[model samples]
Target: MQLVVARIGRAHGIKGEVTVEVRTDEPELRLGPGAVLATDPASTGPLTIATGRVHSGKLLLRFEGCLDRTAAEALRNTLLIADVDPEDLPEESDEYYDHQLMDLDVVLADGTEIGRITEISHLASQDLFIVERPDGTELMIPFVEQIVTEIDLEEQRAVINPPPGLIDDSQAEVASERDDA
Candidate 1:
């Protein structure tokens, strides 16, 4: 499987270094020196990492053969994809890849089916599972330990303990009105 590891940001300096918005939890392994990554735009790369560093709390990378700012900036907004094996599990038991979580059945602890996971939205604060309900309506459920109580990969299901207003439409509207007031 091919997974997106990062997205190239603006050029860092006059050098060939460019900033990257990391999408993966394991940047060190995927964005390390000598790592060859496939780019989204077929023409741009298969880029090889020459060097990587942390500058001002941002990850900066220099790709092999990208010798100047012009070369680096040209890669802006390009996605970095890494080849991954489907059978390869994360080192930590609690860790899961986005692919692994995709399409899993979402349900309440009482076994009431809610929906199927359609996508995962990765935000700075937390990841959200975008679920498609039976009627084709979509709702975002925060992928947190308190809410997503369990993930049973074998059974292909996620058990959640939703808080008030999270899944209840009427409760959500009431909460919204309360905020407006």
Candidate 2:
């Protein structure tokens, strides 16, 4: 299993140090020195981390053989990938990798089938699940604890307790339904 650990940003200085936007939770473990990572273009790497540090709250990494600003700048926008075990769980028990949640059936707390998770979108602030319904329609649901109540890997299902107007088209309709009941 290959996971994106970081994305190379612009060159920091005249040295080979380049800024990196850390993607993985365990940056020290994933992007530390001596770690070799693959690249997105597949030709730019595998980049071996010669040195790394935190500067101005951003990760700075210098790859072996990249000795100058020109060499570091050439790696801008390149994704750093780490090879991990398929069964490797995150350090945090509550967290999950994107692959773990993919293909899981999505259901309401009442067991109403909504769809199956087709993709997990990692956004800036939060993640979203792209669910495809039985009819081929799809919906994007925020993968927050308040909405996604439970994830049963063995059951291969995710139980959602979406707020009003989330699964439904209109919040008014959902409110009215509650009133009628």
Q: Which candidate is the best by TM-score?
A: 1
lDDT of 1 by residue, 66-168 (tens): 9999999999999999999989889899989998999999999999999999999999899999999999999899999999999999999999999779887
- What are the Cα lDDT values of the candidates? 0.95, 0.91
Off by over 4 Å in 1: 171-181
Q: Between which residue pairs do clashes occur in model 2? A: none
Backbone clash pairs for candidate 1 read none
Q: What's model 2's lDDT at 32?
A: 86
Poorest stretch of ten by lDDT in candidate 1: 163-172
TM-score of each: 0.90, 0.85
RMSD of each: 3.0, 2.7
Segments of candidate 2 deviating more than 4 angstroms: 118-126, 132-138, 176-181
